[model samples]
Target: MPRRGIRSWFTVRVTTALFTIPLWLDLTAVAVGAIQGAMFAARLTERRIDLLGVALIGVIVGLGGGILRDLLLNQRPAAISDNWYLPVATAAALLGMLLLRVFTKLNGLIIALDAVTIGLFGAIGTSKALAYGVPEVPAVFVGVISAVGGSILRDVALNLPIALMHVGSLYAIAATAGTVLLVVLVSLGVNVVVAAGLCVVVTTLTRLGSVRYGWSLPEQRALGSWRVWRRA
Candidate 1:
């Protein structure tokens, strides 16, 4: 090969390897999310925890975020193109099913695991966007979406109120906050791994604290209707 050709090939190989970091991040996130999804399905006695239901929810929670993120970035989703993605997801789902059978009460574990995945996905997504030369603000949005998109899909699939739209444990807010923290740390010359670790701690602590303390964002009521009622 010509020297220039060799150099170009090497550059492409290195770049592709670096990009695989995000893929691995998403894969691990999907596994965690799948376990949590199965746990959630098990918790709902009404859902009856069918194998098919557990597997379906697992797949949704596993792949939905990355698919959406990739589409938004105008890149082909790794979850679809990568040969290992589906098998990993399915295997994780099966492991989750097995865990469900072993653990009689998994709610707390599920919540904790879900929080961890949120942080992982958020950090990875933000890093990816920044690597791709995305601006700070939009990168933050991408991070938040990558964190919460899977859970949102899970909610929709289960016919539950979408977690992002509801006054629940600060899901999107936690993701955004973590991603912002990560971006700031990276800008300050912190190592990306350290920044990601900090983000995971921040996101997990915030999410778990919100759930523990029953914290919620303030609700908006229709003051206009109340005023008319009082006048009448």
Candidate 2:
């Protein structure tokens, strides 16, 4: 029974990874990521970022995942070198600006897409990291970073508070969990697609559950040496 369960989870992860992406899917994710970047920019920068900022954010969202992957792998950034990642991100950001207000108002839509983004990138991150011979634990970290780095960049650029820093339903936690889960399943000899599918389902459910139930990790305790700090 335990073996079957592992197999099932692994199958789930891989299917989620492979099947969800269509030949035409790049355009959608790039667009969505770009827009997410732009909206983050609009609120982040103390003063508005000009066209350059928008374009940069777009690129960040579109290619950010892949770039982080390469950097972790100790290779040159593919995001900067390869394909249409730049243009796609820029276009998405521009489009995002148009719809951001409306999108923000609709919590459900944002939540749904955000969940998708987390799943896609988190799994990709895990896959790429492992390819570079990253250990399982670090691979999971890489995956989480890829999943959230772009948005984090956008928020920092906009001068808005970092999303991860604030109180919200599990955001990075979901991505990290998915990546780690996939890695564990693969180590156990489960099929790749199944692993990815399980990752996505786990990620989506975790995020939705967090939002639905206000789930959060406990606050960190102070250091072992509890010294009362002197006021300045």
Candidate 3:
């Protein structure tokens, strides 16, 4: 009876851990973001982002989103406060820097990587916010911000135009759709892992599909610019 009871307890603990697996998504997201950041730095020779710059960008990409999300959630930013977060990010950054040269020529791969990171972060963010009992709308917003925050930081550091502000891609829209879907499903009592998987799939597909099909939001042309053009 004692041995049977111990086995049952062990099974219960393992089952609990399995259910919490979604919490680890952030780590994978950070790794992918770091790799993308390194690639971005490699591409910006004209901007003079060398090896150290690459590492800096990688670190920012890896942790920027989580920091922002934590701040918004009124929690300690794990990226800054957690020992493991820094070490993991730093190691990933160094690895990205070391691998920078080889991936420079893999055109379109960066876009794919960006899409993947967005999906991972978006799903993870929504799951976390929901777990914290955040209100539904705010949870969705958190997911969107987490999805785009790192890239915004990366662009700002590089002195590049913010990708989210542009009309060229369905970045925010994709995140919104996925996050909303996840929230809705969870509300309907879907399994968390299944919901998260679906969210990631929708986000990634929407982003990559928009890119492939040249689908973009309509640009809002400035009336003043149009008037000036007419005068000319």
Candidate 4:
């Protein structure tokens, strides 16, 4: 065999070994995402969303990230390819609907779950991108998209302003920080599972802290005012 062929083969194997996540964990992330989506839809009582509408929103939020990630990677979407994802998402969405009042009262729990969901998706996306030999920066981009793709789609489907565009919590920023950390740790030969765990922790903490303290990126107007003040 040619030396180049051997090197490529070795890289593929190592990357695959390092980045693949267990199926159960991935599904858990999907379930949480679905629940969040349903809850968001439920909150819009004024929208007059029907039961079908709620389920659809849940499925979109649950599966949107993975679908987007797969499309970008030019692969079949795992959510569709696997039999379990759709049913799980649908059921979880219904569950969310059933427990809406309870969840609303426990808003902190929802926020915590949201943070963990973001981390899980981000880690999964980054790992898959790395396994596919995507460049580090691009992998981080993919991860962030995977983390927030569902919410983006939900807002678009409902014709609402995209939360990502608005100055809200550190949603994308937290995802980016986690993904970047994963890439850095992996490059340093850290254990893949450990790095992923750390990614989740960092992402979750950043998200929770932002929520707790109302941290947000400066809006365009704020930035403009700062610049004018500097000029003065």
Candidate 5:
């Protein structure tokens, strides 16, 4: 019975570890995030993420979105030019495995945290853009896109329908919602921390509600009965 129980707990740990993993190492937080992301993909189907594959995905997840965000803002590529990023990703990968061992049931917890990450992703992009004097509307969109881009890449690599595309929570919608919220709040003269907190709250609630009640936006389909009849 104990052996069986251990196996069951092990399964849960593996999933959570595979699921909520993040980039934690200070050396290069972004790189760690990328490595953790690819490890996430590799673990979903029980296939080992070899050094090359994991490294590639790690870099992709860690720096790809930021690169795009920076380019859009006309800044230098931080991950490539900076020295600390790669080590950060490596440490984050190892830390994920350790965290998994500690929490046997973390899928839900990870998802919750992932929402916060999304919010941070959006807010960071927006604030940075604004600091650089980018216009409000463009800054907001850039923020929202950067927030969702990492997950999009992670999903595509895993061969799963992007969660943002499926019926269920408004993933992109949440990001968009947060981005707009930030823009409006800032325009109204709210402090950045306060504005960011509100953005995170909205984004988190949007995601949590989707998880809790399976909420999603309306689907598009052609209506066969709605053909227009011309009255001559």
Candidate 6:
């Protein structure tokens, strides 16, 4: 019947949209992460990292988060299973390295992209954990790990101080906020895709605001001193 045909068409369109949106978003995250990694490596003049080293670092940054997430969940990494991921990451890294000067000049743009990258990763990670029946709190933890795992690996590889441990922009906090929001929204019957999009927006705004305002958690020593003074 005409009604049946219309319903079938709508269902097909909706299913296709759901599948394609996440795929594109994941690819976008990989590309941005690779570019950011390449730029970071290129800036470290003292390290004298070669093109291959830069590319490797880029790949690690691009794929590290998802790998960590899967490992924590006791599953094989999706990045490894998918063919598109590696090629996209490598190409993006090369592009970043080749155009280092241009990207460096657009620092603001890079920061924005970095924010978006983390948001996407966090959303994807949290959603996946929930899909696998991970509890709410642990799902948030996974999301945070996925958001920051790449940078953690990069710092370790480069022998730099771990950014998460130091006073810096609220990277983990932003991720937590976003993931929590996504969980809450989903519990409230929001569509997963729509919730994920909102999560990205919240995370992006939090990250950008933190950078603009120099917002960061108090240093450990500072917090200790405050506690001592309060006791006094």
RMSD vs true structure, all candidates: 7.3, 6.3, 8.6, 3.7, 15.0, 6.6
Q: Each prediction's TM-score against the native?
A: 0.79, 0.77, 0.81, 0.90, 0.72, 0.88
lDDT of 3 by residue, 1-232 (tens): 4334423433454356323654456677787788777766776778776678888888888888888888889988867675667666767778767777766666478778779889888887777776655767898999998998888898999888998899887989999999999878766656667887899999999999999998887676754467645874
Question: Considering every candidate listed, which one attains the maximal lDDT?
Answer: 4
Best model number under TM-score:
4
Instruction: Report model 3's TM-score to 2 decimal places.
Output: 0.81
How does candidate 2 score on lDDT? 0.72
Clash count (model 6, backbone only) = 0
> Could you tell me which residue pairs clash in candidate 1?
none
Clashing residue pairs in candidate 4, if any? Answer: none
Candidate 1 error regions (>4 Å):
1-26, 42-50, 104-106, 222-232
| Model 6 per-residue lDDT tens digits across residues 193-214 | 8988999999999999999999
lDDT of each: 0.76, 0.72, 0.78, 0.87, 0.64, 0.85
Candidate 2 Cα misplacement greater than 4 A, ranges: 1-27, 43-46, 221-232
Off by over 4 Å in 3: 1-19, 22-24, 108-110, 222-232
lDDT of 5: 0.64
In terms of lDDT, model 6 sits at: 0.85
- Please list the residue runs of candidate 6 whose C-alpha ends up more than 4 Å from where it truly belongs after superposition: 1-21, 226-232
Local lDDT at 179 for model 5: 79
**Count of clashing residue pairs in every prediction:** 0, 21, 0, 0, 7, 0
